[model samples]
Target: MPVFGIFVPPTIKRLRTSLYRDALPFSKNLRLKRRSDVDPMGREVSSEDSQRYCNVPNLIISGPPGCGKTTSVWALARDMLGVQIKDACLELNASDERGIDVVRDKIKQFAARKVTLPLGRHKIVILDEADSMTDGAQQALRRIMEVYSSTTRFAFACNQSDKIIEPLQSRCAIVRYGKLTDKEMLSRLLYVCSEEKVEYNNDGLEAILFTAQGDMRQALNNLQCTVAGYGKLSKEAVYKVCDEPHPEKLREMFELCVHGEVFQAFEIMNDLYRLGYSVDDLMSSMFKIVKQIDLPEAIRLEFIMEIGKCHALVLQGLATRVQLAGLVGRLCQTQSRLASD
Candidate 1:
């Protein structure tokens, strides 16, 4: 929970149970196998997960950006007695050089540095965006973790745990976080609006929520920018401030695709492209809108898969209007085939 506000999810209640359980005592490290299990949020929870994670000294906390992974560990470090969190915790983020050298020099040195702490409270070295670290660095860090298991604890915060090396991941418990619900985000937004005297209409807030896609930091940042740029938060203002492909226009385009109106959909894509939006911007917006729109289940899934392929191409530097046009054409073909069948 931030000093400004709290939006901890229910899955985190289980973590609280683990955190307060035995005050971070490690009886013995579990020699678990290398597993590719997705985080708790990626799949259903098991009763064993709650019990197994409490005593693990090292943790691989994975989630989307702004989902409170880093904050949770900070809160834990703050609550410890007999040591200042600033002194006991070694923090590294994406901006830092996270190569093999840093793991060998910086993190290793931190673990070896002697510091007194409350019994069972080990010094924490937090690596934010651990997925960005090099494989060699992760390998080196895993060895350090094994060597220094008694004196220090390691916490790796990342957006995707799968990128972590298997040997390293095996030694740490995996914790997954998900995006905030819309209702939770809205309540917080409304509170902020009242506190800041920010005038916002429902449509404006809804746009923020849509653009935010469950990331609180993005929502708040967009909200602030909208207020700064427009003096008030309205649908048009938020959209203009954020400046992405508008969902309403994308929805109109998608409806055309559903009816096999290829030229119409391409016209919308061309217009959005001419507005200076990237192909990635349009493809992602299309994907998000497709999830909630009322369409036949088979067609919806096919559309999403095609959009994903186009998005991949966009990421690979083929971010042209041609890719967008091709994606729209594919969606139209699917709908035409479905109608014929």
Candidate 2:
């Protein structure tokens, strides 16, 4: 198996120079490129991605879901092709079909065919969610790569490369990626807001990033949802749409449960539901509240145990409306009971 690492060929260096400088014989006017192709400040390739602009064609991009792995690589391909990317590159989602034959067919087309201009400079295949491919599919891919080394360049995008077969791992240069940093996310968000000309409050961008958990797609989607509801955007609107209710709201619900207000507690739970708070969200917040107070270990243990039971019931499909309501009531009651004691 060939070792996996970036080896920038001399040809790529010359080509890169020619594309950027006007003095170069092949250099053309840069005014024709679309704004979307550049970054927020109009640099050609994103600074973070320029390190990856070297000559290594077969590449593996690993990162968590929604970190913009798919988008970044496609952008690189688009820049390389010097045209709108349509058929010159193919993106395959491994989880959708989960069959090796499907991958084989696509690989055949990507490797064997020659795409005309206005598509790309060279043919590229982006295997999105590549880690989801079955062992059979991966084995088939290994065979395919051996057959077509020059014409087809494969880029595998996955959250974890450890899940990929070693043989397949050895065949490509791996680019490990982490979640978008706060600055990077903000940069991307500001770009979006500026382009759409959406009116935004000072904290609105922070609110989007906080709730997105480092996923660009999540942030983008939340931004869209906020815009849809508020017409223009504001921090409060984002908080509301994201269901990032005030801490007081959670405390109120906790208080209702603690006082043995089973019916009222149930009502609060309904409100949370209407507000789109998921079960995970409710449990996570409840856990945080329990952690804040210095409660006795034994008592806290008991509460944790009960909460775990309720969580399992909810997840196991055994929970009824009454049962879930009762669980919430118990959790709220437990917290208040601890406070009093």
In TM-score terms, which candidate is top? 1
Residue-level lDDT of model 2, residues 182-292, one tens digit each, is 787787777777766778876888778767767777788888889878987777888788776544466676566555676776787777766766665666656655544
lDDT of 2 at 88: 70
| TM-score on alpha carbons, each prediction | 0.72, 0.62
- Whole-model lDDT, model 1: 0.77
lDDT of 1 at 319: 80
Clashing pairs in 2: 81-121, 257-332, 257-333, 258-332, 258-333
Candidate 1 all-Cα RMSD: 11.3
lDDT of 2: 0.69
